[model samples]
Target: MMLPTRLQGSLNNELNDGETILWLDQPIASRMARGAWPIVLFGIFWSTFCAGWMFFTINMAMKTPADQAGLFAWLFPAFGLPFCIIGLGMLTSPIWVRRLALRTVYVLTDQRAMIISRSFGKTHVRNYTPEKLNDINRSLNDDGSGDLIFEKVISSHTHTHRNTHSLGHGGHRAGGGRSSRTRTSTTTYGFKCIKQAKQVHELIDGMVLASKPVAEQD
Candidate 1:
């Protein structure tokens, strides 16, 4: 299938001289959004509960006298602010995921596969060679839509930050505490939420097997 004009324009510069496009498509946005339902449901409950708790704290603070309220009144409501913000973000996860899908395009070529994404005023193109596509995994849905998994990349992320403390009695002493967190995430690359996934997966699988050296194939 021909790609959208915008996608074609973005992809033209990356193609080899004679590369042939076997399949091209954008993921189904609505289909992708379906996966976020669990997050949305949890977010709804979380946001409701946090908002209610924050409001209750405010009510209590208002009813209490200033002398009794002290710093607890101010601290109580502020503590819930971040959770409320986080809950709001989760509530809109589906909408954000769907928007992300709309800006993504997937392509299968005679020699490689590509996942193109447009975000933050930039076009990013990812290409997977036959070597990386050797072990293709596929899952098809009842409606003829599915995902082709070509690469499983395990990445490690690290975040480092420092903590500061205050000293007593007009003497200032400074000490630094460092904290680091390491996380591993497996990122799957492929054509996701596309129609006729079985056929597409088979086509790519055959090409992958054929691309191997004669010794390996035998």
Candidate 2:
């Protein structure tokens, strides 16, 4: 298939001399942003804390007598300035992600699958070659549009540990049971929320299978 008109210039530089583009399309921006609320909520919580800290600190500084106020009073309030800015960035990230979805393109070629993204004023091309097509998963929706996951990157998570201790004859010799919970996050790379996801998945599977050595297929 031919590359979209808008994407041609951005992608031509990245394509191989003889590479065949089998499919090309942009993700549904709304779908790309479906997972945004969690992050926004977390951002709100984070910013609230930071903002609260700064407010209270500054209020205290203002109440202090001019001659009695020390350098630490004003300095401590400034510490939260950067953190609050970071929190605000997070709070607005979902909107930014949605906008980026408009600029993002997903392509599948005989040689590879690619996600061409424009982020922070730079173009990023993420490729998954036929050799790396060991695992391909899909999530379908009733509307006949869904996601085809080619890559999953789990960035690491915050883990909370809780321990329950029972005192035996001696506290030093007591046995303890541990319980832990974690808030894990994963970044999925795919042709997200596109039409005919099943067909695209099957087509890519076929292409990958055809690329494999006969012995490997057997």
Candidate 3:
């Protein structure tokens, strides 16, 4: 199939001598924008809280004499800094997603599916043949754009722990720790936020069927 001129050069570089492009498209920006709400809310909450804490810690550090501040006083602002940065990232994740949609491209050929993404000044290309795909499924959006999932997507979650210990001079110290744990995963790989999803699914199904042996088809 004919590809957009902008994508032709990149895809041509990846194609083998005889590989043919069956489909090529980019993900819909609105769909990504819709998917970004949860992240935006989380970012807002995280950034707001972390920024407040960071300001408070710095204020406390300034109020106390350097000699009397102790190691914990200095550590407080240091610890808060990373959290503040992380929160800022979370807050801006939606904009990043939109930018990513602009830089990402998807393609399906008779031999395989390909995803080309550029982020942080780096380009990543992922390829999947029919054999490499499993449990292909579709999720449709209200706008008729949808995602096709081919592989499982696992989400990582972090658990935090707070410990309070009594120090020698009628004083108590508080410390926090965090660990990551994974839960059940959902499907991840495949075309994301494309139009006419049902047609695309059927086309892919036909391709997969045609690739199987004649005996398997029966």
Cα TM-score per model: 0.75, 0.78, 0.76
Question: Which portions of model 2 miss their true places by more than 4 Å?
Answer: 1-7, 155-185, 213-218
Ranking by lDDT: 1, 2, 3
* Native-to-model Cα distance after best TM-score fit, residue 91 in candidate 1, in Å: 1.4
Tens digits of lDDT, candidate 1, 54-94: 99999999999998999978789989999999998899998
| Cα error of candidate 1 at position 214, Å | 6.6
TM-score of decoy 3 = 0.76
- For model 3, residues 1-218, the per-residue Cα lDDT tens digits are 44445455667788888888788888887678678889879888888888888889889988999789998887878887788788878777778888888777888888888998776766678888878754587888776778888776677665655454545555654443444555555547779999888777887777777778999877
lDDT computed for candidate 2:
0.83
Q: How far in Å is the alpha carbon of 118 misplaced in model 1?
A: 1.2
User: How does each model score on lDDT?
Assistant: 0.86, 0.83, 0.78
Cα lDDT over the full model 3? 0.78
Question: How do the residues 107-152 of candidate 2 rate in per-residue lDDT, one tens digit apiece?
Answer: 8888999999876768888889887776878889998899888788
Off by over 4 Å in 1: 1-6, 67-76, 154-185, 209-218
Alpha carbon lDDT at 162, candidate 3: 49
